[model samples]
Target: MSSIDSQTTYLKYREYSDLLKVILYSSQSVLGAVPLIYHLKHNNQNIIFIQTGTMGGNVIHYLISNGPPSKKFIELKRLTGDYTFVDKIGTDGMSLYIPILELEKSNLDFP
Candidate 1:
């Protein structure tokens, strides 16, 4: 691995459980997704996702991480309802929409 990749993984995912915290709280912000992208860009491991109390009060299962960067995702951006694209947005202000499938799936952790 390159030194940059090593540094990114070391800092972003030092604790496996912290991924949960970051997803649940900060997924919509640069702080959360940047580290997540860094980690995914460098690592092949996937994160387990567990959900309880669904439509029928059942449990659902999925994996919540990716292998590497895809070209489409690299060019993706969040946009407002008015179609204003943004890279970084505030946590509690106007919502920024991300349309990429993987990122939308990652947002399911926000609970």
Candidate 2:
């Protein structure tokens, strides 16, 4: 590929990475692990901590099930699908205060 083509590809990949980061952060916010202020200013969304799902399913399921007060529990289930692998963040006893540089090298990867 030409240099221009490679540069275009790299830029597109970067955009996708950024989009993924937004999605991850937003989901984390829904779990009340982190605030969404970094992503959105003047945000008025009520935050709710996802309770431990000892029953079954993943963390996403837990959040959807126990979403904010305005949205009914049943409504959440109707709006979301099953997330097979995700679970509650920091449930593994990991420290949230780990430095930003260390986060990139975090061994938080799951199967």
Candidate 3:
């Protein structure tokens, strides 16, 4: 693994269980998926990882994830309301939405 990978992989994940609320991955980054899964899992931080894009969820689940977060979630209920293609969005506001199939399967320890 590269130095960057090694660094993130070794961080304390349990501490981030409820703190790390967002993870927005772009298709451009090569080591964006499993490496993150390995890092998060290795540290014991079970997360409701919001995956987006065409191949984003596929990439992560294939690598470090034991399985996806559960599928029994309602889309925050309120977040489902209609909005323009580009509305209430900011640099850190939006994230890739994970499918219900993936979310419903994992036994995550979310807060």
**lDDT tens digits, residue span 1-111, model 1:** 543333221122333244334333444554445222322211335443333232434332333455422332222223322332244433534443332233323322211
**Positional deviation of residue 89's Cα in model 1 after best superposition, in angstroms:** 15
CA lDDT, every model vs. true structure: 0.33, 0.23, 0.29
> For candidate 3, what is the TM-score?
0.21
- Segments of candidate 1 deviating more than 4 angstroms: 10-21, 27-97, 101-111
lDDT for predicted candidate 3 compared with the true structure = 0.29
Candidate 1: residue 103 Cα off by (Å): 11
What C-alpha lDDT, on a 0 to 100 scale, does residue 14 get in candidate 1? 35
**Ranking under TM-score, best-scoring first?**
3, 1, 2
Instruction: Find the 10 residues in a row with the least total lDDT in model 1.
Output: 34-43
Deviation (Å) of 33 in candidate 2: 12
Give the poorly placed runs of model 3, Cα more than 4 Å off. Answer: 1-42, 53-71, 78-111
Q: Candidate 2: TM-score? A: 0.17
Ranking by lDDT: 1, 3, 2
- Put down candidate 2 lDDT per residue, 12-101, tens digits, no spaces: 112222323333444456564431111111123222222122233223111111223321221111123212222222333222211111
Q: List the residue pairs that clash in candidate 1.
A: none
**Between candidates 1 and 2, the lDDT winner:** 1
How many clashing residue pairs are found in candidate 3?
Answer: 6
